[model samples]
Target: MTERPADEKDIVLAAQRGEQAAFSELVRRHQRRAYAVARAIVINHEDAEDAVQEAFLHAYRAIDRFLPDQAFGAWLHRIVANAALDVTRRRKVRDADELPETVASPFRDPAEKGELRARLTEALNTLPARQRAVIVLHDVEGYKHAEIGQMLDIPEGTARSDLHYARSQLRQVLGALRQS
Candidate 1:
């Protein structure tokens, strides 16, 4: 008979006791989610990947401090989000000396799917990190405001408001695309 795979709580318990394999299991279970959360905030693939790796390193070191009763995914989510935000902050600092570009799109064909996706990406990149996180978590990932609040350490109302603001911003950007 084959042994059943350990559940998250069991894995956490084992990891807390200095089990390397158990910790690896936790990383395997949550890596995609961690990357998605990081990517949504940082907006650059390499930066997001770096942030997720940093988050996992931090989690591994802090695994002993983890409470078994708490949801590990939620805890990891917070770490990845913070790391991604740090990447964004560092990027902003680096780009501070550059002049902002005000390029209006020159009549791209709306019927082209690639063009639409590119435009959407451009719009998302313009949002503040928190607003981008709110939009991606709530709209793209289908996470509720309460969960987003926990992950981002904000009130649920703030998550909702950020989502509202982000949607409004995207609408304006898309509207400009349509007009152009």
Candidate 2:
């Protein structure tokens, strides 16, 4: 994507100077991507929103440590992803039956979409959490393997392997769906 307006640098500088309006503008600019990353990990919309909000708070507190050389969006996304994973970890301890939702297209016809989605969701649920996260991040979310590795604290090789395994599993599941 093209760089944010040159004024964004000014906003960042102002935000770093503790200007609330500048910080709010940063939030407004980045919130959608942050929420998408969070929602991809956390599954539940409400929890993802909460995670994004918490991430913004955390990012604000840690803004002093943010490296200006790096893109602000990537940094904020890392925060949101971590917060979302944290939420998932906590929820896992409380809910044994929890499963991540399938990544689905919304533009399809309702009845056919529902059936296909149900099959895909079942397949996704059968994969382990780490594999699911890797697949969703790298495949559905279009994150680079290195970025996914950094977010999940795994090696790039590990992310790649997980994605491979996830694809194999998904293929098997999807094949069964076709057969049925």
TM-scores, all candidates, are 0.90, 0.79
**How well is each residue in 40-90 modelled by candidate 1, as lDDT tens digits?**
888789999999999999999999998989999999999999889888999
* Local distance difference test scores for all models: 0.90, 0.82
Per-residue lDDT of model 2, residues 43-72, tens digit only: 678989989999999999998888777778
Report the Cα lDDT for residue 126, model 1.
82
**Which regions of candidate 2 deviate over 4 angstroms?**
1-7, 97-113, 177-180
Candidate 1 lDDT score at position 72: 95
Error of 1 at 80 (Å): 0.6
Residue 24's lDDT within candidate 2 is: 87
TM-score of 1: 0.90
The per-prediction CA RMSD against the true structure, in angstroms, equals 2.8, 6.0
